[model samples]
Every structure is written in C-alpha cells, then in structure tokens.
Target: MKFSKRTKLNIILLWVFTALPMSIFLYYYYPSQPIDWSIFMLMVLLAIATTAIPIYIGNVTIFFSQWVTVAAFLAYGAGVEMILVQLSILPMIFRVLFLQDLPYRLIFSSWMFIMVSFLSASAAHIAGYQIGSMDTIQILLGATIFMFVSLLSNHVILYSRERILGQKEKFFSRDALWDYAAGLVTLPFAVALYVLQLTMGWLAFPLLGIPFLLITYVMRMYNTAERANIALAKASAFGHELADRLSVEQIVNMFLEHLKNLLPADNIYIIDNLKGNYVVMRALEDGHEMRIDVPSDTIKNSFIHYYFTYSEKQCYVKSSEWVHEAPDFLKNDMNSLLIVPVHRNKKTEGLIILTARKKYAFEKFQLDIVHLLATYFAVSLEKAKYVNAAVEKSETCALTGLHNYRFLNKTLEIEQNRLNSNPHLILSALMLDIDHFKQINDRYGHHAGNIVLKDFAKLIQKNVPEDAVVARYGGEEFVIILPQYTKEEATKIGEKVRQTVEIHPFLVDSDLTKNRLDEIIYITVSIGVSSAPEDTDETMSLLRNADRALYIGAKQAGRNKVAEYLK
Candidate 1:
C-alpha cells in the first residue's frame, strides 16, 4: 500500500517516539551479568514455541504465549522476561525477510512489543510481584495490569497508524476485546507455568506447547461463532425490510439488493412463473439489466419443470451439471446456480435463480437465508396482486364501465407534471354533458337513463382522438383529456361528438316488458373545450374554466352546442 505524505510523516514520528526510548532502554538494561547458558537456551526454546502461531484476530496479531513472558518475569526477574520477549521478535523478523512479509508491519510489531514489555515489567515491579513469594492474588493482579498496559500501548500505536493511513476501523473494536479476553484466558496458564518452574525448574518449559495449541483451537471456534452471529443479524434486518414493502416490484427489488450484499454474484435472475406467464428479472454484476419474457410452456418443458416435479423445495446445481441441464437462454456465460422455490399454500409459487461466474460460489448458510427470504417474497406477491385487483375495481365507474372521478384525479396530476416539463405540448380538456339528462331519466326511468349513459360514453370514446383519456367525472358529467391536440383540433373533435349524439338512435330498454323499445330515442350533448397552457396550466383551474364555459356558452345558450372557454 502506498502511503500519503501525511501518513509517511506520522509513521516516522511513531518510529521515533516508540523505537528511540525502546532502543535506549534495551541498550542500558541489556542482561550484562553472567548468564546461565542452560536457562538461556531453555528461554529461547520457549520464545520460539509461543510466537510460532500468531492468532490473527481482525487487524491485530496476538501470540497466546504471553504466559511464557509472565512466567519468566516471576522466575528470573526483569532481565530474563525482557530477553525472552525480545527473542520472540527474531523469528518474526526472519519470516519478514525470508518469507516475504511486509517489513514495515514486522518492524512496527517489534516496536509495539518492546514498548509493551517495558510498561508490563514496570507494572509488575510496582505491584511487588516476585518469583516464589507471590500469592495467587498478586499473580492475577500483576497479570491483569501487565495485559492492560500492553494492550493500551498497542491500541494507541495501531490507532495512530490507522488514522494517518485513513483507515475506517475503530480503535477499541472486536479485535481489542479479543486481545483482552486472550490475556484473561492465558492468566491461569501463566500462573501454572510460574508455579511449575519454581518447583521443577527448567524441566517445566517443554509443557508450554500443549496449552498453546489448545488456546489456538478455542480462539478459532470463538471467531467462527462471532461470524455466524453477524450473518444472522444481517438476515434479521433484511427480513424486516422485505416485510415493510407494499408492492411486488418493491419487494423483489429489495430482495435482490439484499441478496447481492449477502453474497455477491455475477448474474442474478428471479423467475416468477405464478402470474400465468413467466417474467425473468435479470441483473448483471455490472448493473446492466435484462428483462426476459419466456412462455410458461417453455418453462414447463425445460429442466426447471423436472426439478420442480422431482426435487425438494430447495435446489442446488453444480457448474458441471448446471451447464448441461439449464436452458439455452440461462446457460449464457453462467458457471454456477442456486435455485430456491418460493412456497405458498404448501405449493411452489415461483423460483429465485442466483448465478455467478465462478464455480461453487454459494454456501449452505446463504442458501438457508435465501429460502427464508423467498417465503416472504411469495406472500408479498399474493398481497400485491389482491391489492391491485381491488384498486382496479374501485377506480372503475359501474354504470358506464369507464374510469371514475377518483382515477381522473390521479391522471390529471400526472398530465399537469408532463405539461410543466413540455410547456409547448398541447393538452385539451373537454367537459361533456348530456342535454336534458334529468328529463330523460324522468321520462323513461333510470334503466333507460343508464342505457343512454353507457351508449353515450361509448360514442365519446370511439370518436375521441387516439391516446386520449376519458373518464366519468361524476353523474352525467364526463371528461375527455386529449394530449398533443390544440384548442382548434379539440373543438373539431367536440363537434364530431355533438353531431354523432344528435344523429345516432340511442336504444332504451323497456322498463315494464324488459325488452328493447321499438322507437329509438335521440339525445344530444353540450361540450365545453379548454386547452392546457392556453387557457390554464393547472388541472383544477382548467377543469373549473371548462365547467364555467360549459354553463355560460353551451347550457345557457341552448344544449347540443360545442363551446370553448372565452378567455
């Protein structure tokens, strides 16, 4: 990694502060007194075994061999403790030079150990901690203080280097907690070693390797459990997010996005076959999209059909088999696939296909989570379909079989936004009303009136321009929204409706006999035309202006006349 100028300067300052004092201390306090060759060799052997397997917990590397240093401190004083700790750094340095590890990291690790060793030794001395006379309480207290000082110094240096390098990890994070826990875990071992050395002398050193391996195994299991808990937390969060979605499209999008975050794949396809037709929503890792429309019959005859028929609810196909069994369209450049069938009412509703470029990209845990998500997605799909059907029914006008006022409100709001963007685009609103509609109801009964209204709506729809929106605004008042039409063009269209209604013979069913009337009744309509951005740009304003013009120019003047807003 390349360091910025600021980071380089910070690393330089860290080396100066920690390495300078540590160099001076090591030089002045070097074990100059006559050394015991036998004990020295034993200490060296202990140091090698302790630092052999450096447990990597997040960004920090920990040696479970701190018990050896603590044991040496209690047995042979500060000189032997410092010498044993320094000996551990030599193996790490050799690994960096010959095993091609980063020299900067190893060098920093040496400095951290040296600084931590000085503080821990001083803490042990202040606590009156000596070899044979120390009780269990003194040993525990000294070990705790020694561990705390080492951890604190290392945390400070780690955070300083990370901050300078623009790293986004917290100082007192999971790794620091694990380091503290490791210290606590090694305390009993350290105490045992100290006691054994006092009694058995140099013979006790070889037994350290057994406890060190057991600590390594226990720490590995702890790390695995931590990762599993994290995955479960994410799955729970995603489940809540999926539950809150109101539409099938929204739920599908959220599921796809959440799945990508959990396990990244090169290509993903969600095949929803429950809607009578098959819709394949495909997304590439690079963010390109492909929406495939496959006939349901094709799916029924393909390998997917066979799987749904014979296989269990969840399916996993290896790359070698998937390539041969998958359909031609799905076989395009995909290596591995995971297919999970969404279940509802004890039957499969749809299938989710996860594809990646590499082989064996998915794990058992990810498949389990995908199965859980698919259940929610199936429920969301059913709810969305029911809601959409109800909304469609509510927006329909029962008498004329056209859009009601509620639907008109939504359409007008959309049109007004469009008019705002394209100021030059012509939009015309025609307010049409049957002439003497109340007289027709009273003369021939409501059944005849209903017939007349339905026929009139049909006539208006048939005569209006293509792409025009027609809706029943209320009883006997209909609205025609003509897009891309001027006031003159709309007036001509309005004239066509007025002429057609005036000439066509409207059939009114007999009320008493429940049969068609022999004589056809003729009716006319009064139309008021208003163009958007010409008369008014607002939907409500345009509507009010058209209604006003209809009353003044059509109804007041006489019915069966087409009138445009004067102003």
Candidate 2:
C-alpha cells in the first residue's frame, strides 16, 4: 500500500523538523551524560505527570504534570533536561495511539516533543542556568524561559497547521493567551519546588506533593461544577422546547427522548394519570418501546407506591429484594428501580419510573439530575394544559362546541390561499340551513331549537369526511369547508346530509324546565355547493355564491334539496 501525497509530505517534514535535531543532539551529547539515578527518577516522574489527568479551564487544558518537567530542567543540566524532554513524549505517544493516528504520525509527534524540549533547554542555558548548579535565581529564570518557549512552539505549530489546512479560525487569539496563562500558573510552583529542594534536601520532594495534591483536588472540584452547569443548560434548553408543544402527549414524548439520552436505564416507563388510572403512554424495555396501562390501584399498592403520594424526595430502590411488596409485573426481570413524581398544583400529575438490570445502577448525583428534569417536565406540562385550553376556547363555539364564525373565516381564508397557489386543485364550500327553523323555535321553544341545532352539528360532523371542517357560521346556519373536492363530489356529500337529517328523529323535552326528553320531531336541511376555480376564486365570493344557491334551492325551490352555484 502506498501513502497519499499529503501523508508523504507530512512524514518528510516531520523527519526534517524533529528527527534530524534528535540525531544531532544524541551524537554530540549522549555519551557525556552517565545517567544519574536521581535525574532518571525525575525524568520518569515528569513523564508520568505529563500523562496524568489534565484539567480543562474554559477553552484551554492545563496538564499539572508540566510542573515536574520544569523542576527536572532546573535541577539537572541541559543534557538531562533534553533526555527528560524526549522521555516526556511517552504521554503524547499514548494520546496518538488512543486517537488511532498512523504510525508515521506517532513517530513525528515524538520527534516534535524532542525538538520542543531542545528549544526549552537552549532557552534555559541562555538564562544562565548551568548543569547541576543550585542557583535559585538562575533556576527561576530558566523555568520561566522553558515555559515561554514550550508555549510558543506549540502555538506556532498549531497556527501553521491550521493555515496550511485553510481553516478560518484565528489560532493566536485570546484563547491562545488563556493557554499561556494556564502554563504560567504551574511555572511559579515548579520553581518553588526547586527552591525548597535546594534548602531542605530530599525532604522538599514531599513538599511538592502537598501543593500538587491540593491543586489536583481544586481542579477536580472545578470539573464537578462545570458538569453541573452543563446539566442545567441542557435542562433549560429542553424546558423551552417543551413549552412550545401544545399537547400533553407531545410534551411527555419530547421530555422522554431527552431523558433517555441523559440517563441510561434498562427500562423506562412514563405513566400518566388519565381519568384516575395510571396509563403507561410510553414504555421501554431493553431499548424497545411499547405502550401499556397499569391499574392506578395496582400501582398504588406496589413497593414503589410512594410515588402516587406527593413528596419532594425521590423513591430510590437499589435492590428488588428490599421491595418485597413490589407488583409481580414490576419485579419480573428487574434488579433496581427509581420512581419520581411529576407534581402540578400540589397534585401528583404523573410518575417517571426507571428500571435497571443491575443493582445500584443509579448514583446519587444522577438521581438529583433526574429529579431536576422531572421538575422541568412538570412545569412545562401545566403550561401546555393552559395553552391548549385557551386555544380550544378561542376556536370553538360555546353553545354547540363546533368551530365558530372566527374559525370558519380563518379556515376559508387559508383554503382560498391554498387554491390560489394551485389552480388545478379544488376547494368546495357549503352553506347549510334548517328548513322552517324559525317556525320550529316559535312553536316548540328556543331551547328546543338549540337542541336541534346542536344535533345538526353532530350529524354534519359524522356525515362529512374527516378532512372536512364543519363550523357554526351563525344562528340556525352552518358552513362546511372541504379541500380537494370538485362541485360534483361536494353536491353528493350535501345530498347525503340532507337525506340523513330528513329521516332522523330529534328528541326534545316537552317541558322546558326538565332535562329529560319526551318528544321526537323530524327536520331537514337545504345545502348550497360552491367550488373554487369553478364557482369563484375569492373566499367571500364563494360564500356569497353558496348562500345565494341555498336561497334558490331551500326557499325558491320549496326547501330540503341540494343546489349548486351556476357559474
């Protein structure tokens, strides 16, 4: 197998920039340095430190191990310092292998470290730090120079690579400065350790451990805080998404999708309290999802039953054995379970139950995060309920529960625009009126007339296709909007409505004050059909044409028939 042209060039450049210097350094200086035991230990220590855990601050990463590198350089001469630099490449080797880089790239990376280490040694020598000397000020100067050289070399390489690759990002911006700042923090401490070693002998080595451990602990704490901030940010983003959803099912599904990714479990169940029963709208078992309903009473009596009762604390069961009273279905193929209640207005609206195949699957911090997410779900659920209620009230008629005049006009306008965009598409409109509705009201009662109108709305809803919209236009009148229907198809639908209403019996109570019905009466409706691009393109024109047709068919034609608009 042959390498790509780019890869070949990279390999050649790596050898020129790194391997050449390494060969020269070894030939000129390797024989003179006799491997001092103490210096070798320092070299090994520096290598280990460089490879250990790295602390990320903002956009920059600080490797606390570099402190050991500086100490090795200050205590030993340029030759030992150079060897320490070459050995420090061990960590980079591991990283390159972990990333699965080519073998050539790993060799290049090791050489890159060697070259940087040589430059750092040259800077230290220029700062007047001699081999094995105990000069405190010179040690400090060399340490400072070493840090600056290492930082500059790394940034230069990064900037050059990005420029060659045609990247848009500026490599030498404020973020670079942050990286320099991170290294600066460790420099002073590394120099301090060298100073202590000179004054206190071998005892000073333990002194380095004290501050190293302290700094390590501080970085760990910072990491914990950073993770918490990220979790909160994720929860806040999900909350905004949940608020945009209009239905309880939509909100619950969205919340569950995000929750599954954030927390892994063998099984997850979202049980909603609908009509006083716990119905599982979504259930996941070993990654497969299904919907099932668990009886509310059965769920309440289970070992995880505490979730039904409102409480701030989450019920975390680490082992199934502890839950001896758990339901048979729940206990089957489960080792651990966690139950959290979603509360709204101090009432438990629902429960989020998680099960794991292994015991003690969830940690304390994970449970805390789950509780936080559940709270977010609860708040969003309540908000969606109110939003849906307000929308329903605005769109529906209060008396008949059908789409009102406002919705009718809005729908007609929308359908008109759709028809305008597609000239070939058809939109059919119908104007319907009950025959002798006023006479019925005067003879029977206005309340009886209302019952007939409501029954008429229900009949229209049942007779029309699901895609058609039936709306109450005004008193004793209604409109039906059907998309993709020609005048011939709409006339057929209108005829069906007329026949159904003509034959059906409408029950009414003879006594106005009583709720029970005692009488049955027959009724009929006349319908006018008008279609878009066939009758008229305009919405108001279509409505007027249909109304005129209704007048001709119902009034002039002696009522109870379907009429089509004549051009």
Pairs with backbone N, CA or C atoms under 3 Å apart (clashes), candidate 2: none
Sequence-dependent TM-score of model 1: 0.60
lDDT of 1 by residue, 1-567 (tens): 545566556556776887766656754663223445686677677667667666655455677767777766665655666667778667565433312224456556666767777777677668766544458787777666766776677778778768866788887788878888878887777778777766776777666556666667676567646655676788787777777777777887887887777664656777655555555655544345666667778777667775455534443434666566666557555556777887777766567778765445555666777777777677777777788878878999988888999998998889889989888877888999998998878777888889999999899889987799899988899999888888899999999989998999997765644455644799988989998889988988888888887888899998889999988
Per-residue CA lDDT of model 2 for 1-567, tens digit only, reads 235678768777878776776757743663223445764575467456644556655445456666766776676645555556667656555433312235766665656666677777777677776655566677677788888998898778778756766676776688788788878888987787667766775566666755576667677677757766776788778777777888988887788788777664778887677767666668877677775656767766775456676464454545545457775446455656777777777887777888775555554566777777888888887888889899889999988899998888888888878887888888888999898998778767888888888888999999999999999989988999889988999999999999999999999765454554568999888889998888787988988999999998666898898999886
Instruction: State the C-alpha lDDT per candidate.
Output: 0.73, 0.74
Candidate 1, superposed: residue stretches over 4 Å from native: 1-228, 274-286, 295-298, 310-317, 416-426, 465-467, 500-505, 512-519
